[model samples]
Target: MRVNKWGVGVILAASVLLTGCAGGSDKPADEKPSGAAQEENAAPESDCPELKDGATIDGAALSECVTEAMADSAGFAAKMTTLGMESTSRYNPAEAAVATDTTFGSVVVIGEDAWVKSATGEWQAADTASTDPTVVALSTAAKAVDASDPMGVAGTLSGEYTVTGTGTRLGQDVFLLTGVTEEGGTSVDMVFELTSDYVVLAATGSTELEGQKIESVQEITEWDVEQDIIAPL
Candidate 1:
């Protein structure tokens, strides 16, 4: 697919939210607790499968948990941030909305249509033909959200990772998993945060493209919440 600027930005944002920088630390340096206190305050160990340092995750179990959570939820919303891009997206399966702010300008997608807000503050239709990469990516992302298949994106990297019980996110205790992928002399690091229920709350990662380095972070919430998505007028 021809990756447009907007498409690349969205993909970068979504990927960062779904998976994080591979080798980054998840432990909060300032919040170290004693072993006794950690054990006392931690959720039951059974909540998460035991993961040895530097091992692959249990993909089947992880997928099962994510699928179950998605099946139980009504809808969800997500926010993504990168060096020069920020986006907020919401999905209810049948419909979705995404608003992105980039150094170039603002782009918004509502359902099948995409729009751009110019410097003069006029909203106009983006060139979102069926063959357009941005349109295809946005559509696929919405469908994935509707399917509640978080693993469809991150589950592909299910092996050889170190896991640690780490800091809180969105007020939920999480397990931080990190991994790396090397190709064409470039190494990308990714990190993922999973909640007690196996739900993925956030992901961040860094990679290089066209000789430029890109880093991104993403957060998702409102699982099973009632969300009504509408087209922008």
Candidate 2:
């Protein structure tokens, strides 16, 4: 893992934000995004917030720790799942990639440019800068890092965060955090899985819209690991 990482984001952050930037399709997809190797630093465990079982910490402190760790990431890959939609993303400092498979189809974007998988499973160049509102919306997903989050991420959901206690995720010890995040004037209940050194392992949230409960999950599978991401010509 690289050095210092993470910072809070609007809502659902980057993983959820980028989950479906690509429309859905059934065609075969290209290779996963690639990234170049760059070594970074990671916050030592001792420097992180102390987690005690059944203890509580201020939400703002938890949020700050997560925010810092996310920004310090050297490379990472993650998935976001919601309403039967699943997306995979990979990021390193040099590049990033996001792919979503859903009814709209599959898509890949690097910076402001995009590529769509044709019905025949071929990659077609997409103009993210087009005047079309739909196209513009797709490009709006653009991030400073190769049209994506600098971390192969979208970003993270941030709010007044409170650490409920300590726990484990996928076998790694972690701090469990709870908070409510809002965007567009809508609020959702969110739970975060954070590592000892402040690495974000996953975050999940839910909200009611039109009397229907909607939920989203962000799972960080890799942190500060090696990654390879490349853009299609």
Candidate 3:
């Protein structure tokens, strides 16, 4: 099986933003948001839920937690690393930082248009007329990490999972969950880290791909804050 490195990044990045798909009406170059309009369009503060430490989580409860987090969150910034390549993304409802890395360079999406960053760091138009698979994947995965959402961090699992422990991460309290899946006699171990408010902070897992071992991690460092994810052009 041929593995598209970019697709792997997209799958991990999707963990952060799994609520909606990306696509919108095209905006003329002249219609891009400016000073005041940009400020006016900024995301609002998230009303994160109040969850105590040592709380238990199952698949259904996990889904509800993710729903609440995504609904309250304005947007988020995420880093996903797989096999040694890393892609960082920032997303709000209106704009997305897109997939960016040293290997595949970068792509930015705003409304219905997408742009690719050149080797010289110049931005150029990408095919957004129909639907570019990469762009669509980037779009749907650009929302915010909702741990309970199947489209989010738990996309790889098949059976049930349980929250096993609580601990501190970067001075913040977090809940830990683990799940195991078997495929072709290989066992994949998945672990998740969630905040006291039920927001997913990170997820790490290991599995074999085409007889090669691959480990992946996805982390959400910032959310519900003002992020300047503007069009590169």
Candidate 4:
């Protein structure tokens, strides 16, 4: 299967997100956290996807579920831990806007208007006039992807998935969904921890190549929390 540009961008950012590892989470399936846990330390989502041990949901359905959650949520917040460095992102569905704080700096985008800040520099609009490579690339990516894309990256994936089992994590009921597809010599795989109601708690992806391997993971540390995202410029 051929992954589109949108999909590739996800791989790169997520890969960059967890540069320290080639493996997914170490938490065992049996002891994993809630599939729909909200706030890393706060309560879990009141509305979540829960399924029986033998129940199942397809990839299309999974994608639709996540997409709905993204479009419907009033606001969304998540903390991504990569290589011991953390970045927290807040998304506003009403305005199709997002604000992210990374170890290196900060990024904010509202519609086609984007801004970037360096760890020690002031926020600058990442407009067409920008010459900085990173700013240029970020601007391109922001305009290319559908605003809904960032909220649920797994929803952007192409393939199928079904419930593997069920359990309790972070005091919330959880389900496991998995799928894998291959084209030619390349194989792609995805794993998602979901609330039976369809909220994503975590997602992981990996693929293999001759003599080389790559993997990326983004575990949701918080979800649907308060946010005050706005243009920095």
lDDT winner: 4
Model 4, range 105-140, lDDT digits (tens) per residue? 566877777787655567787654577655555554
Writing each residue's lDDT as its tens digit, candidate 3 over 133-193 gives 5444433333322222312543333465666787655345667877775534557677777
Q: What lDDT does each candidate get?
A: 0.48, 0.51, 0.49, 0.54
Residue 63 in model 3: lDDT: 47
Ranking by lDDT: 4, 2, 3, 1
Residues 1-233 of candidate 1: C-alpha lDDT, one tens digit per residue = 11112222224344322222122223332343332223312233344455444446765445445545443445555555666455555545434454444333445555556665433355556643446454444434333332334323334344445675475665557778787644235565767776656556677667877777777666664444545654545
Decoy 1 TM-score against native? 0.56
| TM-score leader | 4
lDDT of 2 at 84: 51
* Candidate 1, poorest ten consecutive residues by summed lDDT: 1-10
Q: Pull out the clashing pairs in model 3.
A: 16-144, 16-145, 17-143, 17-144
Give model 2's TM-score versus the native structure: 0.64
Between prediction 3 and prediction 4, the one with superior lDDT is 4
Worst 10 residues of 2 by lDDT: 1-10
List where candidate 3 sits over 4 angstroms from the true fold.
1-57, 94-101, 118-121, 128-151, 154-158, 181-188
Which scores better on TM-score, 2 or 4? 4
TM-score: model 3 vs. ground truth:
0.59
